[model samples]
Target chain A: MMVPATSAAPQSGAHDKVPLLELEHLQMLFPARAAAFGGKRGHVHAVDDVSLALAEGETLGLVGESGCGKTTLARCAVRLLAPTAGKVRFRGADITSLGPRAMRPYRKHMQIVFQDPQGSLNPRKRVRQIIGAALELSAGGSGDDRLRMLLDQVGLNPEHANRFPHEFSGGQRQRIGVARALAVDPQLIVLDEPVSALDVSIQAQVVNLLDDLQDEFGLSYIFVAHDLSVVRHVSDRIAVMYLGKVVELSPAEELYRRPVHPYTLGLLGSIPIPDPVVSRSRPRQLPRGELPSPIDPPAGCRFHTRCPGATDICREVEPPLTLYPGGHEAACHHPLNVSSSDIAGAVRSPAASRSSGSVVPVPPGG
Target chain B: MTLRDTGTGHVPVNESAVGVLDVPAEPYAAGAATYRLALRRLRHNHRAIVFGSLFVLVVVLCLLAPVYARYIAHTGPNVQHITEVLDINGKSVDVVSLTGVPVGPTWHSRFFLGADADGRDLAVRLLYGGRTSLAIGVMATAITIVLATVLGLVAGYYGKWTDGVISRVFDIVWAYPALLLAIALGVSLATGGISIGPVQINSGSILIPTLVIGIVYVPYVARPIRGEVLALREREFVESARALGFSNFRIMASEILPNLTSTLIVFVPLQLAHSIILEAALSFLGAGVQPPAASWGTLLASGAPLFNVAPYLTLAPATMLVITCLGINVFGDGLREALDPRATVRTGY
Candidate 1:
């Protein structure tokens, strides 16, 4: 199930080795419940066919609007929610179909940190028991020494391990959550909007702590966030999602410098710049109207309804993720900031070949 | 508009968000376990302590009934003196007047607190009656809580068809008024007795009323517990436990059950009071404790006609019932407040 879209790029040193995690044409559809009598309506297309690869010791930032499938993709990656059709490969093993007992060993290799600090930690349990359960399960050790070490690693006082979750500040409680994920020494940690519930100053501290932990443990992360600026700072590569599809994916700096997809450009434009002069004068490419309901999304490119560059073809034909130069990929016929030479060099990604059967058509040079 | 600079060149922490970030520990709450903290809070509540003591006193006094009857009163609970003269402060008082009016307080050991219409010692009967009432209350509450909690947890956690079945059963039980249901079950169970498999309970046994009252109030306690379990099953901690590869049983036992402790604890005293009152009501209506076995309800029933002659019989039992109920309720309220973690003092950061 590991599609070789990124596999084709051998020169990109990270892709040369087997990817640590791969989501192959993953789709997660939730059956819509009728208003009365538990009847099944049409399914809500939460995560449409999205394929991505994460190399060992890399951070893949997943950014999207509130209703987009970034969080769903993250959950699917960890097998918290098994995908509707596609595959989730961890360390080259197809774990999407593994049963709970069979998935235990694989679970030790992957962990997730949730969004709400307070909600995630059991209020009745002390820090020791909360993190200790994971540690004991994976390593068969419940030593307080190791518990204290994990606490220290997460920038919390080791003595605080005996305390309950509510006694700590929000940031400290979040640290306890991080410590629990780290307890099992997982290689891949899926952070599902971990710092969104925190204050700005505390958010920086937690983000820096995560960065330091990643380097210390050589951990890979799929950092899901709605905050584009935070994702820009942390992700080695970023995937921009719009209504469940990976609209654009590129190297982190390239995504900011030359956003190819119109949706990506709109997301970047929506970020408020620090300087008032630039903020006022800068062109806003922010998408118009609210996100379309995922229950029955529009027929073409899901973003075309809100895309600034929507045309007749965009409304009728679905766009394939065409690979551009520098390993950048975008699923748009009329991509923003792409020159004629760049379009001339583009190739259709392997995962997209089955869906659309054609490369993204080059717009008649305006 | 100005930001304070830190000497270490670190970003300024948000005062409210990171208040407890650097605090070593709470001064007063040093190494306090959650329950220990709750215990300390309970200790500080004057009303709970006072009422709790009162409840303890009532229980202790009732437990000493046999001793009081044998040594102190020199009379058994049902040993009636139909015609006996007693000396009270150099005055001769008949235990039962010729007109069948029972004697008033003799202020003496023989007929202390006076005698009932049957000419039995009122104080002795009251103490013995307390034993029966409290036993029924406690036993019935135990039955109710154990059955309700298990059903609630199973229904709430498994949901779907299991929830559908268990919830409908609870609704069926809830449909009838508590008194009506207890009376119905009591009346039938009273005459026929209860025969479950090899177990046999006699018609006149105290267990009949206990079983009736227990089964009747199940939906009252159960519906709330089911609602709580429903909300608790969806809490993020339960989800987190599932994500940790913990089995469903482990999640329900460790994650869900421990969180339900406070709710269950608060229910115990409240349910005890409710069960006691229900038992009294049943006894009063003659569907509860039968003749020869004394309860506050029976005492009140036996004393109703003698209101003009000897009101002490009815007044004594009524006062004890009110005191017991008030004590349990006040203590229950205090326990709830104490168990609430938010009610305690925090370590300022």
Candidate 2:
């Protein structure tokens, strides 16, 4: 179900003009294995027709469960993994097809903050060496003042520069990782679950640090996360993905307030709200069945089997992303309204309405 | 910085405690912990300690070879050697000097193992031979490590054509048997007499053999270093270094090479032992150190014929050779185990 355009109010600001990064028709497909004797093979669409854009100083949150192609999308955005079929335009330049030598200059402009901080840093190197390596690689000036300033900026003492990664706490090591990423003075950073491996308390500290750094540097971030709450706070616009396709994309506040897609509404409702009274008062929509294997995703809509708003159309023909009134878009044959009414008449059968108290609206002008 | 604040308006500070009680910052430094862990791992192996001590003793003996020579000289000729005595048939009779011989018909007062076919004091030769063997082993291993490290670092870090060329070269060298090539080089040198000033030496001498042996084993040392470099190149720290704008050379040397120290330490002793053994085998085959220039291999070769009559000659040199190799092998094994991170934790290092 596509979001109705009336509900999505366009923002009035100069910020809408400049996009930091844009991806069009991003598709990464892996060759499928043949049968036991190589009889027949099918392609696995790991990432199919995914598109999103980030504005300067804006954090675009990409949230998906495992195997939803969230990580692959992130890697492709930073040019770590080549996209099989897509146009990755960074500042209006197509970089998807650039060779290694040609991509060197872009490497400085874009950086990635990996999920596993321990695996990311060299175990044998000192903190200063790890942070300073990026500077030395880009042929940046290496004055003592410059190095010290970076260390201080990351909230690490300059004197602790001589220490190796194994000597530091998980939080400190992650800070060092951030410092390394910042060394290149990158305009955009792809943070792949930066705080997923840290303690809850440490996660908050890191998230706050990231917010502060973003403001200070005017950097754009593609924050990939599994946690909805965390993504809501960091992201200006959040995209929810399922089975290699974006099921929903909307502004963070709007998406949380009134999610049009059944899958998205289910996700938000499943999250236990911090306020006990509001959580008990609010309606919760828990999805049934496990996420299907990506190798053989559903024929029509990948989430059709588990979607609460699934219909004959959702089972036979995939719904294209329809723009909602408030800039929200969702791919569902039948979508739920704020009052729990179906946007399509498919859910309005006497048998369907009698089975549940939820009112099913007739299709627009049906 | 102010040492103290005025008590009139500000909070009072402890003046005496400021300078006296200094809580050392960053007490858990990397150096102290790494060393501590290494020492802890090393302490668990009893055999390693014993062999390591023996290695130390051998090194000390080689260092004081001059002092040992003087002591032996003061003790006088202890072995009998057949030298410059005419026989009853009017020929130059071999009057065997029992004194200073390593092994002979009679035990000499000071000769521990007796003499060789040429009547050179075997005890004196053993000490001097050790000096040569140890020196060659160390020098060759050093050169091998240096060459291998540089090539490996370049190949693994740079990739592309650099990696391709270095890897191909290494593969070519690795395809050949190192010992066979070393022998061939030694034979070639022997055919072409090499001279330094007035001292002419055969190509089959220890000098040529050591040089050939060192060069042949360079690939062995290099391949491991290349593997290590490749693994380290992908590490986040290396990427961080790149992001920090570090030069490729700086990253390879400071960040990459330093991490490979444990691997190097383990490989060096094994390489040294192999070189020493190869040098001895070459000498025994008469393709290494020429006659009159004493070596453990030469001693064993001469002693082999007299094994039935006087076994001490062969026994003494063979025993020393075995002990030296064993000691080195044990130490190398200990170092390998100690350097392994998983082993370090289990062994309390």
For lDDT, the strongest prediction is 1
Q: What does candidate 2 score on TM?
A: 0.76
lDDT of the candidates, in the order given: 0.83, 0.70
Candidate 2 residues B205-292, lDDT tens each?
A: 5667667778888889888889888888887666545533356887788878877887888888899899888777877877766666
For candidate 1, lDDT tens digit of each residue in B213-316?
A: 88888877778888888998877677667677888789888888887787889999999999999999999999999977899999999988998888988899
Across A1-366, the per-residue lDDT of candidate 2 in tens digits comes to 011112121231124475668887788888887788847777777888787777777788898877889988997887766799877988888999877667778888888887878767776667776666576544467666667777777767777788777776676677778888888889999998898887554566577667768878888888998867777776778889888888777788878887777888878877767699999999777678998877778887778888766767667766666555545666655665633232422332211111122333324223
Worst 10 residues of 2 chain B by lDDT: B11-20
Instruction: Quote the positional error of residue A142 for candidate 1 in Å.
Output: 2.5
DockQ of candidate 1 compared with the true complex = 0.29
In candidate 1, how many Å is residue A180 off? 0.7
lDDT of 2 at A257: 83
DockQ of 2: 0.15
Clash totals for all models, in order? Answer: 0, 56
Q: Candidates' DockQ values?
A: 0.29, 0.15
